[model samples]
Target: MPMDERTRAEVERAEAALVEHYPRLVRLAYLVLPPSMGRHRKVLTAHGLVQRALPWRAPRRPAGALPAQRGADPGAGYDLVRQRTVELALAYEERQRPAVLLPTVPFVWGLRLFPRAGGADELALDQALSAVPAAVRAALGLWQLEGLDADAARAVLVRAGVADPEAAQRAAGQVDRRTAGTAALLNSGEFDPCTVQARPTDLLRRRQRVRATAVLAAVLVAGTVAVAALPGGPPATGPVPTAAQQALDPARLLRTPHEQWAETSRVDFTAWPPRGRQAGDRQLLARALRVWAAPPPGTRIVAAADTSTRPPAAPPRLLYAGLIDNVMVVVLHDGERLVRYAEPEGATPTLHFARVDAADLTSAGGLVIGRGNGWLRYLIAPWVSDVAVRDLLAPEAPPHGLHLAPDGVTDRIPLPPADGVPCGHWPATQFRSSPRIDDRRSFLVTDLGDLAPVHLTYLPSPGAGGPGEATGTPALHSWARTACTLRSLRGTGVRAVNNWAYAQQDLPEGGGTATWVCNRADTWRGPGRAVVQFLPPATGPADPGKTAGRARGTAACSPFGRHVLGDVHWQAKSGKWYLLAAGSSEVAGIDVTGGVRAGAAAATLAVPAGPQAPVRVAGRLGDGRSLLALRP
Candidate 1:
């Protein structure tokens, strides 16, 4: 999240004079050393170095280190927590025996402790960050954490210390020269004490990393084992099939080769691009997505696109794309990289489409995923716009059967019909975060206690139109949303109603008041934003085009009901469910047809911010498993 003025002031006050946030930096760096070797001393020593390096007041006696103090708080600015951690790590490396031997575990642990970091599950994510590549990291970090526009973040990074590539090369040469001087005598065989080294640490330090890794691994394993050993393997009430018509998989509809994959990422904000214009920049972004959509396993990219250019130039750099809304848009960057995307347009011209808000685009870590009820329209209009833009914009009409791809692509994988019972009792997992590499692309996500239902509605679109302009709402979308009555937690696993309200509220580092809510079972899949509530009932749809049977009543959601859900969960096509506790927060919500009533639906109860005011847990609302946390 971006730092507000007050917070920024505190961080600036703390960092401007020196480098990082505070003592936490020292603690983080301490983990890189051999644990048995006076960790406290090492941490304190790191603190001493920075203390001497940047004192409350620069000391007259230059060489001596001062005792570190912690009262000062930079009111705010930048990633205060992160800045503090980086300063500590970098400085600690400068003084430690094995400067390059950064144990990844300590870094991850430090991130988890303060301000919390995301995408820490693998090595590439961790490597993508650093204090040196300041520009790239700053621009991309905002892109990843706050989901800010890439161009904007790039500008901010440039304003900081980063400069263009010509300047960068000059700096690199100067660094080499300074290091090669006779005083810098690694080559002289004087056995320099401060040389950068390999990743592996001495046996003692290695042992420490080993210890932490083993502990974390074992803890996770034991937790899994414990769940498996839980009483009676989660009660036997299986999911009863709902007879809603299902959409044909997109693969079945398309005859050509179709493939997609999600890739993780990293950046270096300090690395600026070359001065002047660059090559094929228009294709840079479009191709970037394609690269990640299909990458070799165990490998990761350095930027959203190119990896060859380290320390890319200039902030506020444009992430170019070639196609958008049926028009070929090529971003121009006199000193920065640009982006362009295309869409279809006809006689009416693509100009009729509204420009996407700046907030909609992300450049740092890549596209963040979100979740909400929405429609998958099946439209069938004559081709009107530019074909290139049309294809990119999804202007073609949706064909019969469930699908998201072109006509005739087959994607059918099946489970018991709506007439049959599911293999388990829990509500099927619903998509939580929208479309991101880490989470499922669910059209409807709701918790009915232990059992959650995640339904994917295939909204038909007019053969020719843009995104948000699909044809018809799918059945699943309708089934997930039904009624506005402040009813009691209906099915099972529900305890009581606590508090509820709908507001355009902004929450803590993660959550916020919901943005959209889909109430009608018939509007499940569509072109607009959606906020789905419930899911298809056991009997399924009474009619031909829906999942919920006997659908009736105004659709609504209750903040007053007690919900028992973890942070994230999902149900695959196999009918098997997967759950993650707030692991992935950003996702594209399911598409709903149109606008939801603004603010909270008229309610009798008070709804404060989630996490406070007795917020409901993220869980299965359809299976009666809603959970609410009581703060201590």
Candidate 2:
């Protein structure tokens, strides 16, 4: 009854392969597994599936096995283990429960484990993977993580029991095509289950379960008496339940002293002192807490995407509580997020939540306290000495003074035009701090439909050096053509928007110099949007310029991604057309394909072409990094 020599060798080989590539196999399983299964379950299930995949009998060597990764030897045993692991994972997803009745090995009790949280890009990729079918997810992981080609991915899927490998591959390709560079995100820590962080599960629930049996008999005897005394048909609705009574107590709310801003090491929201006419109103504070814990029916709550609305676990620090324009307003900072609650004269209360974690000097400058009746008022920081409103489009004009009451609330200003709509005048709040203030710098900010306004800055052409203040004439002239473009970023939780003029080229026929600018809108989270525009020589009124290319949720124009490449079709005054292309300083060479085949050793390229010739472009940096043009 003992195994033969061949079977024993195969078992040993499979086990060796699994042990050698344990992290890779677990990551593969984690990516393919259904996300609906919580992170804790998925982590244990991935390990369990891989552990059981060791073959007792020799597996048939499949034709055209996928190429190995990270200098792997492409052994038959590794291929067998990978195929079996994928098969089991897909089977686990298809069935409501595990495929086998075995308990998860190395399971933990009363503890939940999850992979390290990643930035916005990783969060976005995880969400995208969750939307597709399990087979498609497997195909994507194989293609990205295992470095498999399309045909290889299809073959792997087919070997893993996919009914329609072609369909699954196509579905995965659709996602890949929609989002460029998403494949690289698979390598992030977000999908690696081997390296995880652990947190205790609901200990309160565990205690309740332990005591339930002892209290069962007493509850049964008391239930009869309580039921006989009850007289209601249906119990009236009450406030939402809270775990800790201290959270709901108004007196327990934390407060920072007015002088704390000067002594604090980190000059952020933590340093802001509580101020308002009703700062000491216990009844009003209690009502705000109650509503925040559990809002009545039909309450409107506007929170940023992916932000949680759960009430704070402990009493939050009070930032502001005031009556602004006949509306009762309360703002709280719970160390990570900023919560603003507003109740109009007779309207239902509305709550706003925005993540302010790791806030800096620029972000801590102001918070939008009240917005109603086509106006918005800001709760400026304590150190801001003077406030002014400037028309970003007309930088040559003088700034108008904005009145700030003793309470630090500025006079209401008109709301900017709706998102995506171009307007002639764009008003930005200009804050001037006293020179004695630490890290003092004058900057401009404008509301973006969130609690915090986004900082605006201008980076002059590469020769002019680093980013400059928006107040300067040169920076103002640079921002003139780019002001209107900021409208498109409305409603997005944008942290800052920087405008950089990366390249300038003189026209071939003495048509003067043209500029190429990259405008990047970075969010509080990591993901950002980038746009490249072509601006011709200015003559009369300011032109908005023509947009050449755009990319969303990319780091093309930020510090992390300091490369921008784009192309445009321009016709000189001589009535001759040319395909002009340029990139940031990093791009060493440029290549054009499709309608024309050409290459440039420098960052700039000019090719004679028809008015509407189809073309594509890509570039390579001096450091051996390759980048595609923003167009495609």
Candidate 3:
């Protein structure tokens, strides 16, 4: 049973590539697999699937190829391997749990009860997918994760035994509905596997152990030969630990609070930016108070306080300790600030603090602490101890600061300039007019000694120019009026604009309205330059005569249409002008100006145009709703 030289080489190559792409494969598996499987199992399953599907043979290269092209291309090969692996895993799932007819009432109710408490959109999506039928889930995974089109996705489903085209289309539609607001989140690279920590090596070891265990069990059951008995049989099962025993265990201390007062134990404060050697416990207490008070106004503070005098060997330094609302708040504060941390149960504790507030305190009674000028009194649980506090903080450096880019009409914290200037202060403003061309908008300069400007945009009053309006221009003009009107549509329940193009408006009547507007004024010129049209809901019959034309590039008129026409732009890559478009569901780019009716999906337009020529492209959907974009 020895392996041949070729097979050994192939296995080595496959292992190397898999090791490099392990994280990505795990993330892909997390998305495609059902949430009920949990993180560890999902990672293990993904590793197994990827291992089985890898093309272990050395890649074939054309003769006379350069040295650079001689070896196997892991990146190119990975995509195919990953796709095949997901398809196979899904197929296996389908076979394991074949489609079954369930009672309609209970099935609908079960969908409602599915868990939906995941903090991130990606996690929420995984939970949502659990409620979806297996066939529908497969369809969605193929489209969302694999970037397959409806037709391609349908073909895959059909091959998997979902023979009916309508059923496949219905599954695709269900995916579109369930993942409406989360499509971008699912496609983003910021996935966080909360509890799963298995690596490729771990998976390999687990597989080997499982095989060994199976062989041992089979041998024992068969009793083919009289085997020498070991010293002892399987270990005896012990009774469950009592409440007292559980309370004493350090691991269970955080979850279960003890009523009996135990001697307070002190441990070394290990958080970085170590507290000054001379700093006393009182000073540490004050520092913790400051952090609690510094959070932006309206932030609720939850904290615990401990005044026990019992000191154990190497007691935790009072780096930062305070009581905000009575729950004892203690952290291994660096000399300057509380160490940033996070701790998920069962994983190694980290130094990052969770965003805790008054609502989080479980204690009923309040506590009193003397502050500089007055006594600080707040309600917090007394059960939280120093040991629990240590468990709460994650032991890691702070994540990168989040910088929210400014939307047209909101005050935003400006990011620091490249010169390492600090953001100073931005005075609150009541109302500010949109920026007009040639007119300077007032800026709030930070006081951090840096001249960083935080721009504030407020809702325009009755007569104020629209958001981003050009200055020194007459307000009652053609395109300007249209812009103003579009802005005014916000009053009609158009809460926000998606990609600055599509507006979802709720009608005064029952059904909602989806409008596509051309926000770009400089390039829009033809007869129907600023296209604003209503899109049909996805529940009704398709509208006739809604085809790709000069006025409408790609529009959907079907009930399932939820298309948005992204801004059209030309990119020169490899000496060809590539038109790019993006939207919900599916987007197709059509070369209307070139008189070509054929359409290509949203990522990149199929037609190649000259750089000098103006490209007029339309984004269309399967149901026939279209929006024309002219980039001159």
Candidate 1 C-alpha lDDT tens digits along 152-238:
544444444345633433332333332223122212211111121222223433454576698789879789776667585667563
Cα lDDT of model 2 by residue, 3-78, tens digit: 3433444556667889999999999999998775657778998998888777556444456855323333437567
> What TM-score does each of the candidates earn?
0.21, 0.63, 0.27
For model 1, the run of ten residues with the poorest summed lDDT = 380-389
lDDT of 3 by residue, 520-584 (tens): 21111111112332332433222211111112222222112234344332333245553333343
Best by TM-score: 2
RMSD per model, one decimal = 25.5, 14.6, 24.7
Q: Report residue 382 deviation for candidate 1 (angstroms).
A: 33
lDDT of each: 0.25, 0.79, 0.34
Residue 575, candidate 2: alpha-carbon lDDT:
90
Q: Candidate 2's C-alpha lDDT? A: 0.79
Report the candidate with higher TM-score, 1 versus 3.
3
